[model samples]
Structure formats: C-alpha cells, structure tokens
Target: MTATTTTAPTAASDSGLTYVDPRAPRFGQAITATVLTAGVVLAEPLFIYAIAAILGMALLSGWRLDLYGFSWRTVMIPLVGPPERREPAAPHRFAKLMGAGFTVLASALLLAGVPLAAYLLAGMVAVLAGVAATTGLCIGCRMYQQVSFFRRLGVV
Candidate 1:
C-alpha cells in the first residue's frame, strides 16, 4: 500500500516564504561594520577572516543558525519589542552573499601581501554596511531586488 501526506495551508506555508524581523539585518550590519572597521584600523587579517566566517555561516545555514539573527531574536527583541514590520528573507540572504564575497576577496588580498588594497577593500565594505545599519539603505538588498526583477523579466 502507498500512503500520501497532506498538510494544512497557512499564509507562510502556502506562499512558501518566510518573513524576518526587519531589524535583524540592521543589527547584523552594525556588527559587520564595527568588526570590519576594527580589522582595517588594526591591520588585522584575523578580524577580517572572523567576519568572513560569520558571513559564510549565514549563507550556509541562513537564519536558523545565523548568529546575528539568533542574537537579535533572543536578545534584542526583549529590549526593543517585536519589529514593526517583517521582510522576506531572500533579499537579506542575497545581501549576506555579497558581504561574504567581499570579505573573502579582502582576505585573499591580505594573504597575498597586498595590505593596502586589502584594508581599503575591507574599509569600503565597512562604510557600506555602516550606511545600511544607520540609514536602512541596503545597497546589497537593492541589488538583489534588481537582479530578481531582471530575472522575472527574462533579462538575466
């Protein structure tokens, strides 16, 4: 005999999408900005590699195991209450991918004996992440949306 399973449909389940607290990404960005800034200032490749690993974990497992997101949910939510709005998780994931790419490149440059270029690249990421944290203008997320738009239009 064969058996089939049926599941009830809810908003998220039916849409096949998960929502995230909008503040979570900002929180993560703040940490990223600070870490990258310190790494550049101290000329420490170790710090850069640390952030790269965090970003890698975020990409590999998403919010389920993402340290920053877990911290924001468990710690920040208690102090700040729940977020005013929720956002789809896909864009934020894409943003993290961008961050990971940059950090990995920065690490490579540093390891290749190009300290000046490495620090400058890491500094640029810090500035962008800082802007996103403070201003809610996520360049990486915006880029993700543009790419999604192009994909939908069959232009990608």
Candidate 2:
C-alpha cells in the first residue's frame, strides 16, 4: 500500500479526464468557506447566495475546471505559481458532494426558518473548507480516505 496521499490522477471516471492541481480544490474550498460564512452571518438573501455558491461548486466539481487547460485557482491565487502536484479528481469530486450535501441541508434549514441548524451546518462547511484552504488538510479528503480504508477492510 502506498503511504503517500497525493498521487497523480488517472482515468478513474469514464470522462477520460485526470490530473488536477491539488491547490485548485483547496482554493475552491476557501471560496466555499467565504460564501457559507457570509450566509451564516448575513441571513436572508445571502443564504440564497450560499445556495448559488454550492450549486456552482457542484458544477465545477462535475466539470473540473482544472482538467481543462486553465485553472482560475492557478491564475488567481498568489504565491501558488505553477502546478506543483497533481491528485486524482475523484476525491475532490467526493468532497464537493459532501460540501453540496452540507450546504443543501443548511439552505433547507434556512428556508425553513431554522436559522440555528442552518448556521451550524454552514459553519461546519466553513470550518472544514477553511482548514483545507489554510492548512492543506482537507476534511472531506480525510473522510474519503477513511471510507476507502473501511471498504478495503470490508467493514462498510
């Protein structure tokens, strides 16, 4: 078994697409954090913004902007320079699904007038994404790893 977590992407899906700058997803997570935090702090229409942000994330996760020739993450995020490492897109896609789940739940709560639950869920996403963005520790990626481990062990 390989001890290293980061590996170059292969054709894991049917799309024949692979390889992504590890930082792109982190940068995306950072944006996810910001939008979600705004929704929690501002409330009302801003929560709609949070929903839109989540939808955008889902779109990008499906399309994988980095799989294309250009990554806004590379161009926008300073100090990142060129791509230094590539990782399989599968985990990131899974992470985005996790993010979408959280944000969707949060949005439903907010729409239902359950502000507390909404904020809590959104806050959780914000914290997770913040940790990934700042420390390069992706909570969703960790979750994926754990799930894979359990699957390998035949426990799940």
Candidate 3:
C-alpha cells in the first residue's frame, strides 16, 4: 500500500495520519496469498524467491517501492477507480514487514532442504493473507495494533 505523504493530495486524511487506500492492502494481500500458495502448491522455489524479493524491497525501502502496491496504483485503480476511504498506513506497513519476515524464513527453510516445514510456514502465511484479502481482517495488522496499545500502556 502506498503511504499518503504531504505531497499526495488525494491521500490526505482529516486525522493527519499517514493513510492508504482502503483497498490497496487487501489487493496486496490477495496477490501475496496467491503467490505464496502457488509457491507451495507448485513446489517452485522461483515463486517463493520472487515474492521474497518483492517483500524484501518493501521491507527495506517502503510500500511505495512494493510491486504489489505499484500494480494496485497502475493496474487495479485504472480498472476499478479510487477507493472510497483511506486507512492508517502504519498497521499495513507492519503487516507487510511481518509477511516479509515469514517469507524470508520460509525461503531459508526451503534452501536448507526442509521443504515440508517451508511449505507449512508459507501455507500458514497464505491462509492469513487470504483471510485478510477476502474479509479485510488482517491478523498481522490487528497484532500490530495490539502491540502498539500494549506499548502505550507500558505493558509490552
């Protein structure tokens, strides 16, 4: 998902929080779920590696550099028009980083010859992403919010 910086007029939110199109994260999750599922189902390292690379870029740089976000802005938006609302960008960003960590760990497991374990991890991530994409209930994002809350309460 793309973050609404001060420069993006369309991304401005009344709360002044960084915002993202409400649909972008869901679309990104859909792509993520599909890619991870394909990697496990097809037993293809290439698919996993490709997703790993994409997520790595997002984790290292920002969601603005993510291929999924780019695709959403360039392709999906053109076909579907703009989203009706925006959501806080931090939770989605946290989710992307968490997903990246999972993929990276899965890739390592695959490289270490633990294919079953790798597939299981990737499959779990796929299921989580699928749920998020279809239902707009992001577990990782929820986890982020909870963690943030706990941190604020000095309970983390």
Best by lDDT: 3
Off by over 4 Å in 3: 1-16
Taking the tens digit of each residue's C-alpha lDDT, what string does model 1 give over 39-110?
999888999999988888777764446778767756776788765656776787788889988998899988
TM-score for each predicted model, relative to the true structure:
0.87, 0.72, 0.89
Q: Give the winner by TM-score: 2 or 3.
A: 3
Worst 10 residues of 1 by lDDT: 1-10
Give candidate 2 misplaced runs (Cα > 4 Å).
1-17, 48-61, 64-81
Residue range 24-86, candidate 3, lDDT tens digits: 888889988999899999999877877788888988885557787777777777788776767
Residues 34-106 of candidate 2 have per-residue lDDT tens digits of 7777767776547544555555555565554332123343244344454555677667767777877877777
Q: What lDDT would each prediction earn against the true structure?
A: 0.79, 0.65, 0.82
Q: Candidate 1 deviates by what RMSD?
A: 6.4
Clashing pairs in 2: none
Cα deviation of 39, candidate 3, in Å: 1.2
How big is the positional error of residue 69 in model 2, measured in Å on the Cα after superposition? 11
